[model samples]
Target: MKTIQYIAAVLCSLVLSGCSDFSDSINTDPTRPGVASGTQLIANAALYLPGLSSSPKGEFMAQYLAETQYVGTSLYPQESTSFYSWYEEPLMNLQAAIDSDDLDAGEGPIANQIAVARILKAYFFWNVTDRWGDIPYTEALQGSDNFTPVYDSQESIYNSLFEELKAAVATVVEGDIDNDIIYGGDMSKWQKLGNTVRLLMALRLSEVAPARGKEEFNDALNDGVFSSNEDNLVFRHLPEANNQNYWYGQIVNQNREWWALTETLVDEMKPVNDPRLPVYGNPARESDEYVGLEFGEEENIGTEEYSLLGSDIYAQDAPVYLVTYAQVRFAMAEAAERGWIGGDAATYYNQAVEASVEQWTGSTEEVADFLTQPGIAFEPGNAMKMIGTQRWVHLYMFGYEAWAEWRRTGYPDNLVEPNGVPVPGRLSYPDNEVFNNADNYEEAVQRQFGGDDDIHGKVWWDQ
Candidate 1:
């Protein structure tokens, strides 16, 4: 684990010796790419999985729902740079690595890595399409085959991604495990995460393609899904130097601005006096020193006595959550509550809250108290809402995660749309898609708002 892994991870650029950039061609053994077959690529990339295990580092920007309330203000974030990086660089590059070899090989690690890479690629693209309408796909990663990949319709991309995950997961061959981290090469967990991804993506599809999304999701869940935490797809962080909390570094090092708890999140959590609030918020120096930046702020305001968009930030000690047991439980809670699956929402609902606190703070009693709060407690709604709400709360550091959830569920309904940056409501197409795949981008644009650049324009699936 001492070596960094780039297998579909940002650390890909981190290089074996920590080179600041990894955008150059990857040659595991610079003297061996010519002789490297599929096995070599797979083994090398698969070996990268151990490095993919990013510690509890940054603020859970994925879970933070960045675009919703964290942005347009001083969240002290790296914009969508990190999000897009995960999508375009690590995720896309890993997929390209596979084209280096055939996907139909006998039992081997590269093939397995390719199959898993495809699944992970689906996950990455799903996030990209959901957040930003049109994105480069077909020709995007060809590198040279097609210098530019066209932006596919958000709907088309979703359908294609869903299919990719389903196909890759189905291609699992027995005795094919060389470099796996989530399961230590155990293919069983691979099956679980793939199924879980299907279920998760399917549900999200409903917002854009109701009948299709629901139909697809129901089919996957009915077959089998992540039954427990062990089956979860998460990156556990080691509390070590250069591998500490992502958001922690800023807070501890006084990285100037940080995306703190908003009045909405703070107030919502405070109703039952959610103890997690303390775990989530940073008290400003004085009452007038408060500045809460919600989503949609036009500009960043310095600490001039504080504002509501982001008056305060969370502690540096906060964890950078990827996916978690609580999230899966919340997903189940929503499925059960809504009859998407057969179970009780209350059970999964409480389970979600409990799991979240336990995962966040590693305390069962703390989670129980937080769940008892009226907001987190279950009532009657889409199991989606219940689970989604917990997801948002639990997503303090994982901004992008909650942002994706909010796009799908609209829970924790206290969304504010401030002016400036136009709220981008939807994500902008990637530069590659815009430049190389001009035709696809044009098609997607027509389907959206007749070529309007407004983020408010809904994609076909979204509509």
Candidate 2:
């Protein structure tokens, strides 16, 4: 079991050996093995899934956490961050697995392997397009044939991803796969993942394309979604040094006490006596209470004055949650409120809150009491606002997804950074694009933002 968990980490190092930077060329690591097994590629791709939720950049954008020392990220100073590592590493491996002709039924069904690869590829592309707006999709992964691939619009990418996810789900066959670190070859869980991702992706189109959003959401829900917390997509970190949680590397290994709960989050949860507060953070040293630092404050505040993350959160073997049942229920609640589904919004809302509480605290002991509170209870008048706010809370460490939700719904409308710069709608393109792929990059920027490739520009779906 331990060796199984370490397979992805091993493959990552082997595949990426001696590769300094992968941005210049389409083919990375020319010295590495060219024809890796489908299973090996799949394992390599799975390794990157944990970083999606654990990213500090995402946490800062979402305002769930703040910097205790160096506060550059909290102030949102990054104009361009690279997507090259994503494409070069996980995305490339997934694409290789999908395109591989190796038929080893002993490892797993070829159909199933391809299906999983396609699903993962679609997910990686979804993340990229959401962050960068326009990215190389159609012309990507062409190796030496195309060094400069044209950027696809976010709208086109989303449309293609919808089709890809549906196709991948339909392609699944009966078989357990080897080197499957995530679900241990549980095909049913993979099916649920496919549907749940499709459902969430569909909901993202609610504001911009309501009719299509309703159709896709209903389709995914009808097919199937996560039935319970058991079906959540989580990446469990290994205790090994190479596979340790990202937080462990920062706080435990390096002795860096740089992160704390943000005032925006602590105030909201503490005031409501949110049960997850204790599980989310430790009490401040001076106050002996859960205290959050004002986000982006330039003052050299004492680290002991604010709450640090819970011990379990930074543990080496901690599990990173990619998606959860609570998120699905919240989506259902919103769909119900939008008249897109045949269910009571309050019932789903209540279920969502209960699930979130259970998921965080590992028990439902406080759920009944928590729900009855005047402010916590569902109010029909403020249905959408309530759903959005509660959903934001449910998405504690899953920062990028939460940030994307905030952009789409504009709920928790009180997120004010004291620095006076409004939260960005999307990340700017990386410098590699600006210099290497200048023509295509400039074209994308001009088409999307009227020649300005800044973080403030909104994507197609942020209408």
Candidate 3:
């Protein structure tokens, strides 16, 4: 009986081992690869880009909108903010697609995919570096091989971004791209966006590196930037609740009355009869006219008295602009004013203001009247201020870009801070960096701003 039992156990063990081997053999099919395609990777990366521009903190910092309830972010406080998502998600996925075996073997033409990824990666890095002065660029996103990446100077990062943009625009090849939400795999649009982004980056260096800025700006303009409203780089949000516009999610679904139009913004627009004011905000609850609350007065102000975000902004399917023709035209106007380009500054300025009005109102009638206003007209000596202020108004919902521009140009200069606190210049490094990447964080602070992570410390470009 014992011998028989032993034989049965041995047989059962052998059968289980055979099944395990069979399962392992059938787990992978050679015809169906498990790796994500370049197209899919790019689509995923594109989804993350719009969120950077959606943060309400940016609007608060730029003084476009004031907080009604929690005003912590509006009044500058030393808080750590992490930008690891830029590296961990889209950038990592893009790198994987670039390194895929199918791409290298020419299963599909990889040039276009590579170009798009490079351009987007450059954009993400540019956003990150602009917010926080220096960041991990050269040695970043290398998993397991390099855990602690050194921070690269903002200057070096910008230089590398310029090269990446140039190569990306120049390397477009004939290929079919899938899952592209921005331009539906249109290489021409992607090329234009790349050049447009290059133009923006070049303009950032106007004060710090004027010669290089002029050279790159001209190169990008020649390569072709955004030409019209059709060429704007925008992300169209879905109607679904999970994928609705950020403002929709905040104002409608969340049932929160946190944001109100700022007095600074309303005062500027009301005097000039800016047509975009109605499009930008609804009338105040107490009165039929548009009214805004002062920044950092949440404790004193009631939510129902001030105007909330416009109904158009709460629509689920609203499009978020990554880059707009209005912005491009304004950049051109500034470039011409600074003698970086040959066109007349006034022409570009008028075109920019008109484009901005038409972009919201879908007509040119209101623009002509607005331009005739005293301060609205383009003055050669005050070209920079005029362009900067109009750009601020044009970039209404695009908070991050607006804040960056405000810091750089100092237009709309009289931003009233609560409690006599000055506006923040840069966000501090995330707390995780202090605990995890301590040495690198300390070194970055020491080298960049003499060992203090103060919000008032200006970035290299801002100087």
lDDT of 2 by residue, 151-178 (tens): 9988888889889988988988888888
Q: How many residue pairs clash in each candidate?
A: 54, 0, 0
Quote the positional error of residue 220 for candidate 2 in Å. 0.6
Q: Give me candidate 1's TM-score against the actual structure.
A: 0.75
Task: Write candidate 1's Cα lDDT for 199-259 as tens digits.
Answer: 7777676555657866777777765667755566654334444444444454456544534
Report lDDT (Cα) of residue 283, candidate 2.
Answer: 93
The alpha-carbon root-mean-square deviation between model 3 and the true structure, to one decimal in Å, is 10.4
Rank by lDDT, highest first.
2, 3, 1
Q: Write the per-residue lDDT of candidate 3 for residues 109-217, one digit (tens) a residue.
A: 5788888889888888888988889888899878767878988889999999999899888988876455566776678998999999999999998888999999999
Cα lDDT for residue 433, candidate 2: 88
When 1 and 2 are scored with lDDT, the better candidate is 2
**Cα-based lDDT for every prediction:** 0.54, 0.86, 0.81
Question: Residue 137 CA error for candidate 3 (Å)?
Answer: 0.7
RMSD of 1: 6.1
